[model samples]
Target: MFLPFSRYLAFALLSIHETVCTELGTSPFNLRPFSINLSSGVRTMLNKIKTTELPHFPEYPGVGSSFGIDLNTLKSLRKEWLTSFDWGKEQDSMNQFNHFEATIEDLTIHFIHEKSSDPDAIPLLLLHGWPGSFLEFLPVIDQLVQTATTSLGKSISFDVIVPSLPGFVFSSPPPANWTVHDTARVFNTLMTDVLGYSTFAVHGTDFGVGPGYALYDEFNKTTRAAHFVFLPFYPLKPDALQALNITLSPLEKFEEQEFIQWDSSGSGYFLEQSTKPNTLGLALYDTPVGQLAWIGEKFISWSDPHAGTGGSVLDSNEILRSVSLYYLTRSFISSLYIYAQNPHGFATEYTKAHTNAPMLFSAFKYNVAFWPPALAEKVGNLVLYRNHESGGHFPGLENPSALIEDLREIGTYWTT
Candidate 1:
């Protein structure tokens, strides 16, 4: 799980429309809420799929989709996409939540702002990582805003702010030199200045861990706490763990091997996306099926096979919805910009610990990136940590209930 420590200095967006950046200071009035309907161009592209064809894939594999996404799965997804997947209905469902666009730092940031009726609801920011969009949060956004009284008899709810990290969906792209640090700064501004929250709790996974940690480190006074499903910085090495008189549990050892296997077979996209984005971006920008196979591979490889939210079991419909949105908005490539702009993929710092903010981590057994709790505790003020046998990378999709519970639990530590 250990890579070079210096690489994190690099890893770090695109716009749907042409919103020019003017010198306007941040304000809530600058934001506009609206519904997004499928455009004529996107509708035509989806229609063309019925007649257009995908080439056949010759059989060559031990496991289906192990080397890459297998052909059979790819075709199956396309079939579901054409038949049962309804983008208009899905768009209507998404629009039910309050979606907004605001000009901040010359970038038109897109986000889902769901506020609970509870005047005392905890202000929380939920950040999504790569291989996901703001859509990933759709399953749980409504649930998160609902009032919940924990088993401990504590009542809690959230004013959830889920922003599309600069270049992913409708949000504008960052400048070429921007990194996650820049993202952290802008997001801090969004929460405190733009939305005008006095304080907020943060949760992150995958690519989100970078900016989430950055907010925790830099804006200690405003960002009260953090909960993460993944930490870019890893736990201490096995030898280092032993020297520290710590022993790995059987599950930890097994997960470590699984993590290694993932690096070998499942992570080629990271390198290509990080090192040569433009070359790869052009190749799949327009081809729907191609984009499907490319992004479709990760949802299968990273999830707990039996896991997901509600009836939405991270199924073909769900997968295609993700790819289709990215394809239609022309953001599949723009999202990849984070990789190239920040080449420090998994090599984030493991040694430094900042305790100003209370840190809670949700450790899923199959997350691919494994870190022991003992070493993880050294990274921050480890207040609450839980391990789950279910869910993988995108908990918002895989286990919305668990993700929601964790966010509520973390919110309790915040004081007025």
Candidate 2:
């Protein structure tokens, strides 16, 4: 049986505190400098994927027949990834940023710590969701950290912290029974106890929203503000929509149509991941092409259609880098366990007016899930909500400039 939200939060906090003291011999955790050096053995395995022959299947021309990633797209990506893509170059680019690890509870969390020169910069925690590693934030971290002159002539910046969720990429996997709430508690320890910040703001999309909401609810005093590109527990009830006293706009209606269509046909991955993750996990573990097909399909489908082009908004290199990380670390299977552990989904009770932290929501045009401004207001102290004309689920990569500008707006609300 699942525990009540309040009890779960309390127990999680106590557990993290005890683990920190016992393991590290300190009440608060400490950050240890780290480096990411991929082994030669892993590199050899990745190179082997390029030469491996993929089985050919005849294509039929129809939406249902092509319900998944087209065979042609996967073949092209595999060829380029094997022959031309440079993992070393990508690794060096990632290493240019400050990276560190800290033991919080039973997991050793890996994160990028980018600091701004501005003394007044606020600490901002950026979290990434499934099929996405901390890599999703790489394109925008520099802009977020750079000092920007506002309309009032004041400068603003952020001390950005992007962590690999436990069991994803560099972070160690949690116990078999771990849930998102467990991640939330460990992350709170990261900010307050490890990093020594009394208050911070959070921004998240996809699975990141689970822990993001957890922080907003359980540590409102410390999580001073929150911003989201996706709210996992949304589509407010009909009565809740009535309470907001507003009608859906044309854009919102389009979002609804898209959402319904996806729920009917595109939710197979969700059901499988949340129910029999290990079963699927084992099947895909040793096969590089299988992992690519599973993850690359989402990257292609969920992104905004390329403007004036016929494919995904993401470039070839962008998609390959994400897949390469999973393939290299052999952590693809562990990442899926997060879904199995939290089969019930994000806690709905926390979504109901649990905190007064200033909240902001951005609805990207092509996101699978969309929440209107009125509906968003019911969840928290809705301070700013906007609809974008471009971008999709992965706004950080698809439209970095837009995402950065909106985050700066959050900084203004935070300082005021």
Candidate 3:
């Protein structure tokens, strides 16, 4: 929470430099500091789930029973969430960081901005995916903002910015005509106009990857660098993979098999959200437990089994916090619209073109799509690519320390 005097001095110096450089261009946009204040009605609904009567059916037999979140697991989680969880404390903890809202092209965008005391800290933008809020990055946020010296004696720090993507929780919903490209333009304004950062780095996962890629592709001059855990685009064909001139290791082969299995059995959510989000969202909107079952399934299944032995790789509180935000803000339905808006998917030839800006990829061992290092090169000016042994799709939550360390390495490519 506190930086050393030397580190504080470094931050102060950088802050002065940033002020001088950014002050030259007056921002056309306005950014107002905001706070989280859950309404009493929403809080009451979240707390009443324990007493609400849930539908019951006879347990199905065999492996098929695990096809969805087991009813008992939901019941137990509901009990704990209502009885043991404390939303007030959690809200206060989140409020500890700086939060702001900016109206970008008529839509209100909510974000957390934690400026490092080290004036030289690189400005970094973090994007979160579906079923995830800014909460995903909370575990590693402090480490990123604090000044630290790496093993090689490199001083590393960042001016961290984590935003709720359009229509996710606090952020306003995207217009019907809006796509990820539109979101990209707004976020670009957010960085250069609202925050007055001339250039910044980006990291994204899941749905966030779409906007992240859009920013890198469409605004390479200002988006100086990027890192991604998910690229929402189609994987390269076998022939194309062969063209990369790299052989797959046994571990890589195993990852391929896992991906195949996942695509076959685990992608139903995609179809529903992309095609008929409203139909399902309306059905689940009134029932908190229903939303839990729908979103909680992915949190449990998509995470690495080895990451946590309990119900999910993420703790109960983490999962509930995400769901609670959606419920309280009434953004669950709008969040699903991102899938519908980008029906063609994000793998365009334009996105595939390489940029001069440095790009990095961190492929988690248990991620749904296993993008080999060879295939990743075709996408960008690939500078750093690393594979982890034990994280899944939600690395920010499943493995924060690893995510933080990888993000810190991005500073190596930062230019003045």
Backbone Cα, N, C clashes tallied per candidate: 5, 0, 4
CA RMSD of all predictions:
8.4, 8.2, 4.1
Ten-residue segment with the worst summed lDDT in candidate 3?
A: 6-15
Query: How high is the CA lDDT of each candidate model?
Result: 0.75, 0.79, 0.80
* Residue 257 error, candidate 3, Å: 2.1
- Tell me which residue pairs clash in candidate 2: none
Candidate 2 lDDT over residue span 63-174, tens digit each: 4324898877888888888788888888877776667788888688998877776778889999999999988888788888789854455677988999999999899989
Question: Using lDDT as the measure, what is the rank order of every candidate, best first?
Answer: 3, 2, 1
TM-scores of the candidates are 0.88, 0.87, 0.89
Q: Which residue pairs clash within candidate 1?
A: 7-344, 10-342, 11-342, 13-167, 14-167
lDDT of 1 by residue, 1-416 (tens): 22122211111001111122223332433666545665655666667666667667646755666578887877787788788788877776666666777777888888877777788888888888988988778878777778887646688888888899988878888888878888888888888876778888888888888898888877778888898888867545467668988787887776666677786777788889989899888998877887888888888888877754453357777787788778777888889999888787456466554546788888777777777777668777777877766777777788777777877786666664
Measured with C-alpha atoms, the lDDT of residue 141 in candidate 2 is 87
RMSD of 3: 4.1
Best candidate per lDDT, number? 3
Candidate 3 local accuracy as lDDT? Answer: 0.80
Model 2 CA deviation exceeding 4 Å by range: 1-30, 59-65, 149-154, 236-246, 307-313, 347-350
**lDDT string, candidate 3, 288-330, tens digits:** 8788888887887888876554323477777777788888888
